[model samples]
Target: MDRAPFHPGPPAEVTATPAGDRWTLRFVRDLRHPPERVWAALTDPARLREWAPFLADRDLSTPGDAVLTLVDGDAVVAQPATVRRAEPPRLLEYTWDEDLLRWELTRTADGTRLTLWHTVADRGLLPMVAAGWHLCVDVAERLLAGDPIGPIRGAEAIGFGWTELRDTYARRLGDA
Candidate 1:
């Protein structure tokens, strides 16, 4: 799909570690809902299953932040993550492995603008991660609006510019 990921604030920066070999993909979407409503979909396990499912048949949402054990039948994937930043509905940040993700939401005239930044320790994994996030965030948007969810995610650009998009959000927020 040729859907656009919308945002209206200054985008945060995601960089490589001291290793200097990491890839990070960030997704932003201006949602049509309040911060409290948006927070519910993110923190709630049942609500998260509707969107943000990393594995096809696994529940990744658990309150109080701990090592997440994701098992689909036999195979299992353990992800170490925590709620790094939580401010009601303003921001929610966390870390999974060497990657850090932050979703910052701001109240707007129309709705809330949510920006997600995902840092990957492996550059090769960018494409898959980006595409999956696109789909999940779109689902999240639909969920926030009380609308039917759809499966739609765009392809990842091999070389998606970061600063340009970040600057765009920064400018828009300034104007807003």
Candidate 2:
């Protein structure tokens, strides 16, 4: 018998809330892993490269200034970032370029519940962002489970059903 390939079904649960001039998209996902383990994947630079959309120059486990390089195909843009808060395996807040990302990990009976609050100035970008995170989270879970399908990001993400996910999110999230 052969195993079925991993295929992310749809976008995760996300809510867009108005925040003055910006919009905050809250994405919640339940991973079958402990908070401590999830925290390592979220903050470790080496681990992030395996599942994230960006590559961190250093570990994001501390509160301080850091650099995050976003890659799209051969285009790599290094963005200056600041880690505003880091609370071990619980909470983390940081900035990626002009966008602010806050992650909260709560321990659940099954595993860890990860909630991401991302604030972006462009409301039109919500669906796209949501789609990106959906793929990232799926990859992250696989990595945590020791299956490791590698990272799906940037232009390469389109090959992994990015368009469909984006469209689904756009419909679900509405005109934003």
Candidate 3:
């Protein structure tokens, strides 16, 4: 039997909240997989490479300093990160460069609810950030379902409707 093609859904459910001088983008996604499975994808280096926007040098399951290399085709930029909190398949908070990322995983009746609070210095980048993460989680969900479509991020995401999602998110989120 032929497999069905994968097409990412619409923009994720995201909202922007003010955090000191910076802004925090709250992105929520519900997956059909459990928390343990999703947590591995978010913490494991090899699994992160398959879906995340960056490649982790070490497992993010522990609280410590780690390096995350952002790759955009031939361009690779290594950024310093610190895992401030790690609570198994529940909460994981870390810093990526100057930005702070907090992940909360809650078990749901159907599967798991994943919420990402990313603190960024710029408010204008919220929509773009949401769009990028929208694709990342979508791909991650696919990977968990045993139907990986590879990672969609960086410049390459433009070819996979990233621009459209960004625009849509911008309109949905509006300017505050």
Candidate 4:
């Protein structure tokens, strides 16, 4: 399949809300695939490596502690994370470093509605994180559409249209 050219464009609709001592960054995307398919991409390491920023030591469909290996340039940093919630194709929540990451999948008329809530304590990193996630989500959508475009990592991920996305999100978040 011929892949669509990657474009930074406008950032996805993201909302940052305060959650106690942290802020939750929420991203919603309507995928043209079923929850099962999307869930596989979200939980399976093989599928995740195709798009996600991190790789899991084990299948994330189970509730337990799993090692998360984040892609940083040529290096992979491993971290221990406990799965807070795992319910097949519907929900998955786990620890992302010191923060909590939650993914919710809902069946929609056209496809699946995927929502990601990432708890962030560093307010300064919001734009950067948001941009990185926007790119990751785009890559996942492309992969599910049968036009996988490989992985973007570390400096490349941040350099790959991140500044534009960050600027866009900053404006949207009114943090500029």
* Top of the candidates by lDDT: 2
lDDT of 3 by residue, 1-176 (tens): 11246566866788999999999999999999999999999999999998999999999999999999998888899999999999999999999999999999999998999999999999999999998999899899888998887887699888877888888888877852
Instruction: Give the alpha carbon lDDT tens digit for every residue of 1-176 in model 2.
Output: 11147688556899999999999999999999999999999999999999999999999999999999998878989999999999989999999999999999999999999999999999999999999999999999989988888888799888888889889888888967
- Ranking, lDDT, top scorer first: 2, 3, 4, 1
* Least accurate 10 contiguous residues by lDDT in model 3: 1-10
Backbone clashes in each candidate structure, one number apiece?
0, 0, 0, 0
Q: Is candidate 3 or candidate 4 better by lDDT?
A: 3
Against the true structure, candidate 4 reaches a TM-score of 0.92
**Clash-forming residue pairs, model 2:** none
With a 3 Å backbone cut-off (N, CA, C), the pairs that clash in candidate 4 are none
Listed in order, each prediction's TM-score against the native is: 0.62, 0.96, 0.96, 0.92
Q: lDDT per prediction?
A: 0.56, 0.92, 0.91, 0.84
What TM-score would you give candidate 3 relative to the actual structure? 0.96
The segments of candidate 1 whose C-alpha lies over 4 angstroms from its true place after superposition are 1-21, 55-64, 69-76, 148-176
Model 4: residue 135 alpha-carbon error in angstroms: 0.4
Q: After superposition, how far is residue 98 of candidate 1 from its true place, in Å?
A: 2.8
Q: Mind sharing the TM-score for model 2?
A: 0.96
